[model samples]
Target: MGIKIGCCGFPVSRKKYYGEFNVVELQNTFYDLPSIDWAENLRSEAPGDFEFTIKAWQVITHPASSPTWKKMRRKPRGDTSNYGFLKPSNENLEALRETVRVAEALKSKIIVLQTPPSLPYSRESVEWVREFFSKASDIAQGFILGWEPRGEWSKARELYDIIEEFGIVHIVDPFRATPHLGKGGVVYFRLHGIGGSEVNYRYKYTDDDLKRLHEIVSKYSVDREVYVLFNNVYMFDDAARFKRLINS
Candidate 1:
């Protein structure tokens, strides 16, 4: 009925997070996927009204060279050259399927595919994204697909076009830029914080910042679902403050 706010991951205990917020954008799914049984257990442990939105596996969006891969519990294997940047390679497609399997286990309605920040946009790169999503669509049925294209393509028309063409939600850091909603009219904000790249994780939202965020997300809430998931270091406290500010 209104803007759904939460942290990107559990900033506190799951029980506390679930009690305080109605939705969460799962970040662990990006680093390492939980086994289906684990995902099901996690889901069963949450409150009945809790909602989950998954961040697609890093193998599909980031290359083996990506530092993010170092956090994986199971090391990557095989010819990983084709992995990441949505290359539509066998490795990436397989990763997509695995992500979908976990999403299904969690009963997640949204599956977000985020491109690596180092990805450079080009004609070939654009085609690769298209090809990946094209293959991904088959496995993405019954879920709201989201794309967070970073670097040069973050706010480009090509990203918008892909979203429109494939009916995907645009995942944006609303503090940096406005999201260009496509046919579905869904708004998903990943609030990294208000600052330069270095300041993102450390920065905290002020009262004015929360007021502006509330104003921006409110515009689209009347028509479609709008999500605001905080990803900063102070996400737990910040999100709680935001909820109180808006509800008060």
Candidate 2:
């Protein structure tokens, strides 16, 4: 068991980032799905042992009203509410297929599907997720499906049961909540800062915070691979510091 520390995005140049860390959770894929050629080029440029985990395209989970849509090359047209939210629509399914293609091109081991806070905990939501994953599982084969459910879905036991049923890894912010879906051999932790009602991206971690994180990693990394990804203001520095702490 070992710990892999990285940031949500490349905070430094690719060469410098690869020199420091062996893993990165690509954020670009979440906002916009890149061409397979572009993804392959990135994969070829990196070291063979380097690990790439991509965030699934927004169209797989977010509705068109999401501000993130503005960043996408093709914005949804009228009645965009049904475009996403895992509604099993053709557009969303096509978007997910594209996302899977990109991940395959990059040789990504994990594809993270982060649902928006608006997708609350409910029987309908759970059923939607189950249906979506049932279809998505066929296309996203050969990769671990990681899910980061926001809002009330984070606390719902039914959600965890569904996750376990599909063998999905729970992506979580350890400071916010312990993951309920504990089926996989990988423990993915996304650190988005602490001491706020929501994610505090402005916060910077201290040595004590790093030490606490180290303790958590040590406990979990004894058998499983623990991925600690920083998603805060000082992500690069914080991740580096955490790497050094864990190594020490």
Candidate 3:
């Protein structure tokens, strides 16, 4: 199967961006759980054929009251982890459940459980996550749960064991998650570039990076649905570039 290419709706105008790509990640939901009608409006903006996968609210994975913000360069870096969306409280879980409910209504395919870089792969975190999945999956219907690890944890195999056991997908960027490419199950590859992590803005994949990604996509085309997203948001034009790259 040919791998499907899309992007996270970061720096793009939905009206124009959705027309180019077949999928766009609803990342804003990671901060605040919006109403169903609002979510549907986003879906409506995209073509009828396009599919959307939303990131779960951050309260369960990234709680508030962190000191990293002052050290960061941007505001609302849209990190999701900096907010109190992942607190280990009833209210937080309830909010997560409601988000899942909405995604299910919209027939969304994946719910990203993106964890912060600081969240170590400890036994406690694993157990908590397992329990959260157990509860969330029940309410999520058939929506797949996926994750993107921020830091060095990307190289750890133990994290894969947990994710695999839970039957969750791993979201990876070539620069950060390249070392952890041996993972199985569903994989979401976000191709930024050979070394575009520094710019972190609108960027494009280098020719070499494109060749390597094309090879990887060909390698994994046998069975699994490979969801490849673009992250370089050049003044809200990243999705258009991704479309041109794939359709070229």
Candidate 4:
């Protein structure tokens, strides 16, 4: 298995992060996009092998009421109704376009759409997301799209169909649920700790947990590249540890 290990964000300074790890998931893009010049500069600053994977802009996945907007470097200027929960509307599509522009600047290969539980597994939600993926795919050429569906969608039967139809990588926490295979050719895992079904950002992963994680990962017989990103309070340390374990 080709496992790329890193933190969800630059848990340390960008320079230090680039020195220690080759991959990072950009949470900043979800909150607000960095200037194109800045993203381009960072791309130049890093090693050529370094990779950036983005968390899609919140306007593409979140409602205005979401607390995630509180950290925005800037706020939305127009009606917020069409935004969030994969509405597949003009505003949301525009939001995705902006996200792709930033991703393009960063040389990003993956743009992840993490949806809310409110848009549970249903014929209507699946159709809406299918259309959203359809339009998003058109905008993001030569880039892999990852969808992390929350709540009931995690174990829902409808999950497999859309992923196959769109060639989307099914992003998940391996501890929470086995990721459904897709045509996207990547197994992406975002670790939020052993909180059962919910995210426990405060939890620190133990050595035994890491062992089990390695074991859990080995169960996958697929030949796809695997991305293991730690997103907890101790992400920096935990990610380093997991990287070492995998390499050993």
Which candidate number has the best TM-score?
1
Residues 52-157, candidate 3: write the lDDT tens digits: 8887766666655555323434233344543442334455566667778778656697888776766666666666656666666566657787777665456565
Q: Stretches of candidate 2 above 4 Å error?
A: 76-79
lDDT of 3: 0.63
Off by over 4 Å in 1: none
lDDT per residue, candidate 4, 31-128, as tens digits? 88778898899899989999999999898898888888788877766688878988889989888888888999999999999988766567887788
Off by over 4 Å in 3: 66-89, 178-185, 192-203, 235-248
lDDT of 2 by residue, 3-118 (tens): 88999999999999999999999999988788899999999999999999999989878887788989999664445666777776667777778888999899888998888888
Query: Which TM-score value belongs to model 1?
Result: 0.96
Q: Return the TM-score for candidate 3, rounded to 2 decimals.
A: 0.78
Q: Could you tell me the TM-score of candidate 2? A: 0.95
- For model 1, residues 1-248, the per-residue Cα lDDT tens digits are 57888998899999888889999989899999889998999999999889999999898888989999899997555688988888988888888888899999999989988887788688899898888778787878888888877778886668877887888888888878778788885789888878787237989899999999888878888998888889999999999999998789
Q: Which lDDT values do the candidates have, in the order given?
A: 0.86, 0.85, 0.63, 0.86
Q: List the residue pairs that clash in candidate 2.
A: none
- RMSD of each candidate? 1.3, 1.6, 5.2, 1.6
Q: Worst lDDT window (10 residues) for model 2? A: 74-83
Better of 3 and 4 by TM-score: 4
Better of 1 and 2 by TM-score: 1
